[model samples]
Target: MRSPRRQPVAGAATRTGPPVPPAWMRWLPVCYVAVVLILEPLTPVDWPVSFLLVALPLVTAFAHGPLVVAGATALAVVLEGVLAGTPCCAGRSVGYLWDRHYVADYVCTVLVGGLGTILAAHRIHRERTLADVRFVADIAQRVLLRPLPRRIGNLRLESFYLSATAEARIGGDLYEAVPTAFGVRLLIGDVRGKGLLAVETAAAVLGAFREAAHEEPDLAALARRMEQSVSRRAAHIGGSETGERFVTAVFAEIPADGRVVRVVNCGHPPPLLVRPDEVRELDSGRSGPPLNLGMLLTEAHHIDSYPFRPGEQLLLYTDGVTETRDANGVFYPLARRLRSWGPLEPRTLLDRLHHDLLDYSGDRLQDDTAALAACLLDGGPRSVDDSSEP
Candidate 1:
């Protein structure tokens, strides 16, 4: 049921920087100068079209740096002097160059140009600071929520994560998949809150899952380990929010044969299982408490198994996906959308979902969003040995 890994398409949601400005924006100041030059000759002498050149430095500052703006300022001053000294339209004389009004105009242009230069410098500083912040955030994302492999053993995987904050690359959402001797174990969860504290809690849960997924043999034991890890982490981060801090998670296991998938739902949204005929939510019959709250409950965590045959896809997501609201406050119809679409590759399916979600929410998500898609391909080892490596 497992298949070999395939190469992913290029330019697949890998951007982690600020958007680039349009090429045309850089020429705006030059175009303005050209227009001013052309109108100067056609207008009457009293019109003084060269006065418009005072705005040149401000226009350049919109896209250029301080150095370029300074150059633009100098250019505007020189052009103004040239227009004043030249005898162009009727009733205009060269004496206009030394006119008191022209003298005042020169001082005004220089003052505005200085302001533009300062503006450009400040803009550049802010941009560099933003770039540095994004770089640090990207590194944190790699360490916390690393990108998932395109293919792992028999499972073809694709993942998507979107932080509600434009400058942040990661947030409270976290996920990881490890192919161990037991099978391909998957973990996806969301911390209770936002900010640095939430990020620290997410890191603790992911660190525990990465380690426990390899060592633990039983799926229930893995869940227990995660719960203990979160509890310990909460203790270490003791504060008023310690009791409020928790994580909703789903742990999944797909064997080498890929015939069935076992899942443990811990106060998280149920994953969707998409088949050629229909789509359904893989809801566990009994729900378990979220991580860090196991001590309060005596009931044991339950593992539910579902038929995960080849050609079927499994989608795990956070509440942000289902809870996204449109202009009318209508929630995104995730299940309905999946049912309407035809059979699609795992990557394509997620790509479509990402765009649809953004469109539904008008590109304004209220919380962090994360999704992981796995497709069981046909043709692989039916039974993997206990010592087998993925």
Candidate 2:
């Protein structure tokens, strides 16, 4: 459902690791200076105390601009000069001015500090460029996975999409919910492959489903339309490799006036029906093959009908969820997990599943995941608040 504008939380779990050091770390150079002040007086000046002076400016360069680094370098130079003239060693300002070792240490600090400042400037520029590119990619992803309204007719809806790759914003998984004359139609599917090829196929399927969901009254017919669309896309892609371009999908029809839910399964995982009393899988007696394989099948696709009582919720997801493996290589038990939740509201149901899936997989999904939860509201289809609970 459409939440307020914000950064996407999906796939964020994968970024979990060491926390970034705090921004206040920029003051570390000052702390280093204080430590040097205490240590230089205690230790003999002949212990090469001036060597420690280079560290303050270099550390400052990591978290600050060149100006700050320059200031730190100047401070280090002053402190070195002062330390060289201390009673611990020479005990005369002329000792630092004429001593070759003292002069050499000061020269090294200035050269290294200047180099660190230049490197820091370059790093900041590169980071800004990378951020701009990533921002554009994120926008493209949001456009691809447009936010679904929380309410469509009397149906409460919530949806999430997670791309498997860390560098990607969108992938092969796809889901769409459309309100039509027949009812609220839903489609959640996974393309056979990843990257641009899969995304192209997903786009074609969604375009076909949107157009046919309103025109085709029968759920099977709508699926056939999607099959044709995928076939055409495969033909256009035109390679021996494109022959493997089929999509596993579950197409659903929730009639506005009926207590029945009709589904057409195309080699996809069965959806979970979460009722107050029990959670059941809406299995087709014998499912048809995935989209783009109608020509290979001897039998026609069949639509399966099941009761969808009011206050009940239906959960549909791509194989990524069920097939997600833990570090120990155990598949996530989606049906069993749903049974534990009883009858949760749409948004909360998806949130729990999203978090649970990431936790189970150690936040590393091997395939793209997409999930949608729809609750059949009483009093037929009508718009409601963004989070209309069941």
TM-score for all predictions?
A: 0.90, 0.86
Candidate 1 Cα outliers beyond 4 Å, as residue runs: 1-20, 42-44, 382-390
Shift of residue 56 alpha carbon in model 2, Å:
3.2
Clashing pairs in 1: 1-380
Per-model CA lDDT versus the true structure: 0.83, 0.79
Could you give candidate 2's per-residue lDDT for residues 1-390 as a string of tens digits?
322222233322222222233567877887888887777656654575556987777888777777888888888888888777655453432455447887887898899888978976776776667667666666656556667777877788888886665556778888888888788899999899777887778878887887898899888889888888898889998988766889999999988778788999999999988899898888856888999888777877898899998899989999999999999999999989888877788888887887788778877778878899988887754532223322
Against the true structure, candidate 2 has what lDDT?
Answer: 0.79
What's the CA RMSD for each of the models?
Answer: 5.6, 5.1
Clashes of each: 1, 4
Q: What is the lDDT of residue 222 in candidate 2?
A: 90
